[model samples]
Target: MAGPVILLVAAFATLVAALLFGGGAAPLVIADAGPVVRWGLPIVKLVVNLAAAGMLGALVLALFALKTGERAFDLALDTASVSAAVFTIGSAVTGFFTFVNVFNAAPSADAVFGDQLGRFLVDTELGRTWLITTIAGAVITVLAFAVRSWTPTLIVALLAAAALVPMGTQGHSGDLANHDIAMVSLVIHIIAAAVWLGGLLLLIVIRPVTDRAPMIAILRRYSAIALAAFVVVAISGTVRATVAVGDLPSLLTPYGGILLVKVAALLGMGLFGAWYRLRLIGRMAADAASRHFWILVTVELALMGIASGAAAALARTAPPSETAPAFVRTPAEQLTDAPVPPELTFDRWFTAWNVDLIWAFVVGFGLFFYLAGVWRLHRRGDRWPVYRTVLWVLGMLLLLWVTCGPVNAYQDYLFSVHMVGHMLLTMAIPLLLVPGSPVTLALRTIRKRDDGTRGGREWIMWAVHTPFAKVVTHPLFAAANFVASLWIFYYTDLFRWSLYDHLGHEWMTVHFLITGYLFVLSLIGIDPVPYRFPYPFRLLTLGGVIAIHAFFGVAIMMQTGLFAAEWFGAMGRTWGPTPIEDQYIGGGAAWSIGEIPALILGVTVAIQWSRSDDRLQRSQDRHADRTGDAELEAYNARLAAMAEKDARAGR
Candidate 1:
């Protein structure tokens, strides 16, 4: 019944989405009416979004159940996830065609496409559809599967943030501020909903397996968490609802009517939660009325599902963007235009990318070679195939040289480009490189040839696996790397001025890559280190770094007011923000929610620390309690006496 009911709701939603969005897309075939002009795409996208969220949620539940080994909470999470998966997969399939016609066909940066592409995306329904799906995917996944552990928390948090990406400028919503607010509120809603609901799942499942006496302790801690989650859901939800509904009259409107239904569902969930906690749960805990608890939680889960489905629609289907892309018929109608194609204007970046096309392939194949070598060594643990390793090194050199060419030619744009480049190099490259352990593995191969550790890879290992390595690998160091780099570059204009000149620009790129490499290495934990810290410290440091990052963002945001730097103004009005507002948002982004990443880090570190501590403590306790033969005991006693004698003598 639960399965069929959820599936029916999902199918109905998808059908409504199809009629409104995809069916409407037939208008796009006209020259003036590409998909960007259609309504069907957005509707289809909404359906896809719901489907994906539903599917992923189900997968998460199934995994949780397996881990719990058939606990009731596990079973419920599994059930809820099943429902979620239905919605998610259905939405994804329905939305895939739209994404194909939208972001894929729509206009992208010239580097990716031409001006016509941008026009198609900006002027059409296709862009809207893609934006909605991307953001929705990021959000829904977080809600469903992001809560397995700290690891999942980190993943989900990141995805939730990603959901806000399209809401930025490219989101074409023109209301970045509103979108920002919605995104933040939505994130709060998801975290609160998952924690609160997931806990209910846990409370129901665990209580049955454990004794009632322990329930008090468990419930005491969990209830506090659920309470906090409830408060967040209530406050943020109210704000979200208010913004979404726009006014009281909306309740009577068709769209508003759906929203009301969703709200009612959430309210029902809340009521059920109250009943379980206030009336039924206590008695259920004391007595053996576990079935009643299950029944109530399932009801809550069902309500949450309904509410989430409505929210999925409301979140992305924001009543059309207020800001429309302004295209000028006259070549000089004077809009904010990206600077490129000095010789001639092209449709998109890719349109003029004869040179870039070749470069892309070069980089792609080179990376493939490097990866193949890495896999071979890791799998075989030998240098019998030595030529591939050489090719790998040469390929890296070639890649660096290729990048160097652009570094010299576009020195003027280096600073801005450097920021973008750093993000890619640090984020994309090292994670792949380190996991292969090429450096270490290569060293191992070299050492075997010499059969000694005088000056081979063994020595390299000694250096990397040393105290300094340990220190750098510490949470403190990673935090420092993440925070200090930005402040050093931006707060002090040394980084700023450095990128403006040709020579300085070259050095800037170099530094950017090196720093990024270290930062990511520390973050991804690919390299080995001995020093460690506790979870509490890890969390604090993570929070600290986020706080620091937020501070920089705040400072940049504030620059919108009459601050120094003609460069900012020269970039045009849109490029530069008012110092005060920019500073506020920058800091807000930095401080307001930056702690999320840190919280995740702290959890990871804490879990590791806890496991290690437990193992060490247990080992020590076991060793102390060891039983042995008489002779061994006598020998130990003699050694103790000798140690006592030596201590007395020294005193």
Candidate 2:
């Protein structure tokens, strides 16, 4: 009780101070909205963030670490429910205040203002964002109250997490030059911060009731989570700062100063975490050390408050200008919110770079966890293949390049480049990734969770055994899905959506990667599955897929008209090949670059088949050695007896 109260008080005080000094309410003067709205909006938003953290963090801890039917677990869920209720209220308040702030309409009995409010909620993008968020919060509040079990609580937690998405989308990202990256970074930042803050609060709340051993275990688990969150927050904060400030000089400005204050708070928390991990946590089992731990936690909570407050204030502060001076806008710039790059060339493939925050994190975590798994295996005297690790690392690196390098830079503007990326995502990258056998490694390394809770290993096994997995892993079905998606995506509005929408692009990437992985896995996966085709059938599957793929490519090449011409043509690129010619080149890439991976898959399947035969023959020879040729001797004796009987009957 004391800890939470302190956290709230600290958060409110710092938020108020930051807003007063940061000029966050200055726009109210021009908008003619009273100070109540000007001041109330950020305050409500801050409370919303805190409550969200509490809801999400408590649910995550309950799912991941807390035991079912335990008092601590129930307490955590109750806390989540209460937090969600507050979140719902806070969100509604924020939305209403936002309405007042944007329209400068005071709350009154007038029907005209009421109509305007109704219109704002339904028709405007901002209104829609808040309305969706508020509704999601309301749903989460109800779900959290009704659900107490692990899986149900987990679902509620996911719903709460999803509720944060619209808020992420509505951030200052749209005003920034790197809109997509800013939006992604903001989303990651918000979620990670909530988890970190909420987990700490839960720890404080449950400390008194938990036994020492279990409490220590919980603390250790949470420490790892907090460390991960800290890293994400740091990286995302830097990206956000870069987007908002634009230059070093801008850091001296009020907005930048508030950002700096937030960074400082984060740094303080990090240092405190280090001390807690290295010094305090080990001693937490000692009666004397408990007081020290509580003191440290109190200080840490205060820092969290400061950081959260600064974040709320920073949201309201004006970012530096995103536009360049005296720069003429191109059609691409108008559509994409960024300037067009130079024409694609061989050199540009190596030189062009766009940092996709999402994939960057994906690759980073993939490498870290995979390597960690390998290290754990080694520590336990198990020898994981070095080549598997090497292949996994290389595959992830290629994925990063495909997503964030030249391919991503030019894909929207150039059809050929888009095809090149699509080929890599759907074929080349998966060929490497499938051979890495990530599932095999996970099954071998990740500890089993048997407490009626889903952990990494449990979830992976469950997923592999699901009906959807069985259907997808079937060679014929996998091949069709792989080939059909190409036709459907390119021929339909999906391609245009991918070109125009960031979320659509992400979905395209994920869909292609999964389909490709399943196809390759059906052919050459090392992990256990429901069924795998024999080598001959595998070869036949590959052959049929390749033939269809080639025909699809040829169909594209023979087409006289451009695909998604509205998007690629309208890019207004002056230096690249004409849109139709670019489409021809893309067709060639689909036909040519796409074949390389098919050949690789064929060769891999052949090698695996040969190995399978060799292993089978070896096993038979070992059985012969063990039996001393007794079966062979018996067969020869039986043949001799049959001959003797035939001779006697003839005589």
Best by lDDT: 2
Output the lDDT of residue 107, model 1. 39
TM-score, predicted candidate 1 vs. hidden true structure: 0.41
Query: Model 2, 206-236: lDDT tens per residue?
Result: 8778899888878877888889989998999
Residue pairs clashing, model 2: none
Runs off by more than 4 Å, candidate 2? 27-29, 109-111, 322-328, 448-455, 633-651
Q: lDDT per model, in order?
A: 0.48, 0.87
Residue 109 Cα positional deviation in candidate 1, in Å, after optimal superposition: 27
Please give each candidate's TM-score: 0.41, 0.94
Q: What overall lDDT, based on C-alpha atoms, would model 2 receive against the true structure? A: 0.87
